[model samples]
Target chain A: MAEVRVAVPPTARKGEVIEIKTLVSHPMDNGFLLDYGGRMIPRWIINRFEVEYNGEMVFSADWHVSISTNPYLIFYTVATETGQLDFKWYDDNGEIYTHTAEITVT
Target chain B: MTQKSTRRDVLKLAGAATAATVAPTIATAQSAGGVVVIGAGFGGATAARYLRRAGVSVTLVEQNSSFSTCPFSNTVLGGINNFSSITHGFGGLRREGVNVVRGRVNAVDPDAKSITLDGGDTIAYDRLIMSPGIDFKWDAIEGYDEAAAELMPHAWKAGSQTNILRRQLEAMPDGGVVAIAPPGNPFRCPPGPYERASLIAHYLKTEKPRSKVLILDAKDSFSKQGLFQAGWAELYGDLIEWVPFSEGGNVARVDPATNTIFTDFDEHKVDVANIIPPQRSNRLVDTAGLADGGDWCPINQTTFESTIHANIHVLGDASIAGRMPKSGFSANSQAKVCAAAVAALLAGNDPASPSFINTCYSLVAPDYGISVAAIYRIIEDGTIAPVAGAGGVSPSDAPASTRALEADYARGWYASITADMFG
Candidate 1:
């Protein structure tokens, strides 16, 4: 499974466009290269990524093989209320790697 | 069977790098020693079981109660297996006298001989056995980061991504391209990517005969190359295409927007992909200063003890074990060697100079398999080198019966290794 990390302000004003930065710990094995001995290393990369705010989808991406390992993303979302922001990375292999952060909105 | 390998010849390596760690005191040497083992995978779990059985008080610390294994995971990628079979629990190890604890090991303080858990509890040990295994070098590949893992599956660790790749294969349109990107040297299971390609191709051949599996390799050669290629030719025919680095196999970047991988030679569009990036020792292992700013921890191959630290031993993929592939069997073998040393060290006895062995079996299909095995011992140069002519790979032209038998051995090895570790 991938390790997803998120950085968000502890407090945000209602209706603020909060900047959310996230990082995931993954090799993103780009099933393209060979080992030192010249064999095709198997590819097992994450292919879909998504983020949600309080159960509402805010962003999603259809990813392929070319992405950074432990890929990081920064995006802006409106802080409408005190709720949890969920971040998820979907693996081509069929699992979802997720992380969440709680934001206190005034 | 070498004429020159006398006892003196073998012991020369021992003299070259003799470990200074022995029972510090005679009176306390015979007492039951405390050992804290971290990570309940092949290396840690096996060491915990063996050390506890050797009359040492062992604390097996793991973050999860259940452990999914990587040895048999290619079957999952082939679409013929599931997680339940490859995953296991620690009940057997606990019942066998190891004090198995489910907690995150937050920190390992070598000087204090103690480990702090996430909840603030601490467990001290006479010796620490760290089998934290390999972690990806996050930026080894351009655009291949953790966030992109969800976008590209590196099902190397044998967890959720195992099934993810299968689902992707299932969802791919018939005749769609399935591209696999394997990691480079010193990674786990050197022959894994080829085996994966073979098995996935089997799935495609059966489920979607028009589909194809493309392997983009970082290296020009691989372990059991003749065997894997032969298997591919015999079984998969023209369905599998392999591009080596000399021929533009290396991917330069990945763009999820188009589900495409750009290689030095050309850009590949695929319906699904497995992008395995570069790897190194786990982050925590390096954080503990065990790796000493290097990609892998340097250890005395004779005792598997960190040359840079005391009262600590590293096993499996984390250690710089020369000539041994980073595989589960190697970890288990290394764990046994480490367990003996830890037990002997605490008991105030001289640890034995141990021999290491590894045999990795990969299935090209359910009833067909290939293997590479080696017997290793420390050499006069103070390295863990393979014993000359001790083992070899399955014959590329071996009869079907031999391949079938290797397949059975693969299953047997999985069952036995899991039992040896967890129990």
Candidate 2:
């Protein structure tokens, strides 16, 4: 589980390619380290990161253990209308962390 | 930035005050030497106020526009205290006649007795005080860096990180496991992590119901452990699980890419992880050459003068204080002691023998609280030794009324200490 923060222009002109940024708090434990007893640390990283705008897939990435904790992602998307930008992070634990940011377009 | 007063104005005010009271050690009949204090946290602010009252020309420099206290920040995570309640401004110190400068002091030139600001401004002083507090030893914890902190928030600094951790806890679903990895000894607030678990469990018990708190401690035991255990048993039951160092509680490493915590024997994949790294004196000590080959500065127990630097004092978390636990109360007490010593030293007299007191109260639940208090003395050998049997913690399973009373006391202590530092 993580707290999600997103940055998007509050208002945009139609067809503008606006930059969208997102951040989430997580450990992204890659299962490489040892536990207190010298056992291997089981990995549980966010394996998939995706973003959608107005029912269209705007951005996506297949992440690995290299993706640090509190994953941050940024991409460009055309402002076609006033709609919500949806974000979902899929982890090896089968947990889905979701967030949404609304954009207003004139 | 607040307007700076001329040295003459300070001397004039000091002269007027001295005429009414017994003259303190004075570099002049009108005023004492100028003292420059760095990092206006509890220690610096308290020293500034007391020095100004003692008629010493003083300037307090701080990098932050406002201070966010770590003492009661856990309450913000529990929704028991508002974020603004723990944040303070420097307007109070300025009004009290302390020249409060807002800037990042970049260097301390010991021989010259001066400090340099980032923009090339230099401040000269006869005596200087630094209480820059602690910094994270990022290398000690593998894969945990400043950027990774955004992913695995420590919330140790009590600002943006605290907010981030709180939001993570709030966003966690029912039946989720919230994990905490508390750093080893010599860190700030000896009993903080447990208090956080207690309050977080209280919040979860009410809201999430099925959630649990897993505490992985670096030590085998902790301050007030018995009382905390008793309270958890009586209130939270199985909602809290503790793993001590003896049983693989020590965190060997953390991976942010997976939100995983690794111990020597086992690995935990948690829903939310709070990783607090080992600490050292703030990096400012390195630039000042004050930390004599250690992570913390060594100070004269009697006067808090840094052993490596003459005419300079270090107080609070950045210095080694034998038996004192790093808490807001401890810092406030040290600052007052340091202020008095600085005044006496400037006035051409040795400082009076120092005695200090610290009381830390923790809330286990909104209505349940416990406390620990200690009295310290600078013995003949100059070690800050706690008076034998002079301090104790609240009794386990105290009556509900007593717990509630202690909760009230916790609130009162917060108000009183903030007043002492910033009022």
Candidate 3:
């Protein structure tokens, strides 16, 4: 599993539609306690995520246990203004992980 | 007799003048009846002062003779301030003509409008204000109670326990672990445990680099998450370990004998343990038949009058102030609104629409601070909601100078709150 990285278009004209990419570092281990050598290993996984811009929802997705470790997601949205882009990831256990990046449109 | 006044007539005039001088004093004492206020901390002290300013006599009943604040207690842990700096005398309140009574209230009778002191004396009041703050739910954490606090200090209420925790931190050997067990939701000062971790980590980085501060949080995320994470990353990234509730951080029990905290799956033995237990309204509120459920007294949002009883107002941590975090600032704000309503009722005037403001500041390091502020107004539905676009967390990517200014603002906020409440 690699670390999560999120990137948006480095430069975009004002009001231009651009792509935003996000990748997270996690092993989406589903809760299936499997015994290896008579030892139980509890499962853990990232379940869902959403993207918002300036307090408005832009894109979202739901994931399952089978979505491989450190899932990367990408989406497109029109840059309307200079504001914040927020990303939130939730694990199967309802643990929420959030990150935000700034976008300035010239 | 007209030309030369008789001595008897002159004496009669003197007697009338003396009676006139004494009449207003007796009348004021009768009309300006004193309110018996329990708890002389932030909320009670503020209410007493404001009531006195409104020409209402006040008798402040406090268990302690002096006041010691929990606000900025993290500074004491960080060695920035001592207990003396936070300690204040009640002389200022006394100078305002408030009768400062030092005794524990045994019982409160709403019907009788009186409070029974532990010394077998009863004080009657036209109105009673109770702000006894929080009492720990000792049973929530097994093997932990008032007796255990001497060794395993919670330090949540601040004073001696705070000093004890600071001393323990100083006494720990290098590379030792300082475990801080934060309670669940509905605790006083939601951001408090995190701030304590930051300040302790600050102390360790300079004095004992090899030492570590472990935060065993019962919740997932806390106030000002981004700012705290940024400070941790910049200052002591690896030295501080925060284990959330999903992990093995949820503490269920503690054995004070061995200085060990027991979670569901593991036992953590630490050099020092600051266990902030689950909290509820003080015992008086519960015993007075005021608490509705969840160990807090429910009240009407507008007047802060108890939902169970009429003409009895409950403010501060004892009241279930909806949508407001249990903080000193929130308590102080609510007390002012409550005071206004009480005064309006006394004057036979309708209470005005009430509003409140709260801004909580947390110092992540000596030079780094963060805050969350909100302005709240009572809606037509009688519930308080944050005024939109009024307040929020500090921007995440703010510059170093902004962070430094935030530190100064944090100090200023403390001074302002204390002044508003006590000064």
Candidate 4:
């Protein structure tokens, strides 16, 4: 398990664009590196990230080995309803880490 | 503002004033015809190039035909880099109209504004920039003189010493103990000893897993301590042990004949010994009377002019720069600022307010890296101070991907900075 940090405004005017920023800690170890014993360290990384607003998919990204460790993402979406934004990070090892941020729009 | 903007402003002013000084120039400004920079290391070379870029005639004197940078030399020790890869020539600087003179400067007559070469030639200068770097205090550690350095190598200066240490490591048998004795504070590259230890541990772990590294440090804490220790534990686990000064880590004596280091409470006989003794400004500064009875040269933060002497500037590891570590990055930054100030002085203009920046990256493993960075400016008291919240070390809990990125960035930095220097 890794620590994740995200920033989002608590409230926004309806139809106004809002910004969301996120950071997560992960090794994202690409398989190319050699260990002390001259063996290749296996690749383990977060390969996909997606965001949902009010149960609707608003943004999604496919991450690769080239993505930096501790992946950080910043994106914008229009405030449509008073609800929550669900953030999910999919790892290469079939594990999904998720977080939720609630937002009020009037 | 940032040092980048400051440098741009200085360069802009220098460019605007170039035509005015072009005809008379630095050559006609003084009887001797231009600026003379001693040493061709990071500080002197950058200063000479920048001055020449501003159309000032500059002569750079160096004892060596080529220079090997101290930065990235540790990678050589870790067997990941070749010595020749770090060595650089002066052709780029020479091509830029810098008068690259290869010879030993025997003496500097500050009053006459002239320096004497070993072969009896005297080069006069409108101003002198001395960046002689550091020289060890041979008397600081017993039995660790120049002769003993051949055996118990310091490898602090790079070049041949670096090769010696690497060769010693390669020749040592499995399970051999390598003892590293680092000096106290205010030395060149504060994080260097620890980085060396980490790289050596990397080499041992790869080829000789039975071998271990013992760091007998003179300080209780070191640069990027938490990050380095965490990386060590995660990568080389139990292979690298650091002994702080409080716990009999301060080396009192070195008996190289028996390959042993003696402290107040204990003695260790190791397979390989690296004794980095305390250091001061290179002997050239002492000979030129620039140190003013001190180990380092004090300078004006804004102009880098020697406090004790007029028309003489010092930079690099030899200078007492406030809040700046004596790293190559600091030297290069100081050199640019000092060059601008010197150019402004020659043009009878007050130098642009100077700022500096330094970023040092150390590799704990081939794929793991950590760094510290800072931006600095002169405060009201005429001393350099780091901008609040402007810079800091890499986050301790950064993911391995972040470390890998830093490692790649470290390699990129080496290529870019070296090109910046040599070009």
| Poorest stretch of ten by lDDT in candidate 4 chain B | B23-32
Model 2 per-residue lDDT tens digits across residues B1-423: 255899898888868877665355434413534899998887898888888877777899999999999998999999888899999998888898888998998899998889999999999888898999999989977788998899888888889999999999989999889898899988988899999999999989999989999999878789899999999999999999999765557776788888898764467988889998899999988987788778899999878999999988999999887688888788899999999898888877779988999899999998888999999998767789889988888877579999999999999998988888886
Q: Provide the lDDT at A30 for model 3.
A: 68
Q: Can you tell me the DockQ of model 1?
A: 0.02
Off by over 4 Å in 4: A1-106, B1-32
How high is the lDDT of residue B402 in model 1?
Answer: 94
User: For each candidate, what's the DockQ?
Assistant: 0.02, 0.01, 0.02, 0.01
Model 1 over residues B27-61: C-alpha lDDT tens digits?
A: 24335347889999999999998876666678889
lDDT of 4 by residue, B1-423 (tens): 344567778888878776666645565445446799999988998898888877788999999999998989999999999999999999999898899999999888889889999989999988999999999999998888999999999999988999999999999999999998889998999988888889999999999999999999877789999999999999999999898765557787889899999764468999999999999999888766788898999998888899988998999999999989999999999999998888778877889998899999999998998999999999878899999988999999899999999999999988888877778
Local distance difference test scores for all models? 0.84, 0.86, 0.82, 0.89
| TM-score of every prediction relative to native | 0.75, 0.76, 0.75, 0.76
Question: Which residue pairs collide in model 4, if any?
Answer: none
Between candidates 3 and 4, name the one with more favorable lDDT. 4
Task: Say which docking band candidate 4 falls in.
Answer: incorrect
Candidate 2, residue A82: how far the Cα is off, in Å: 61
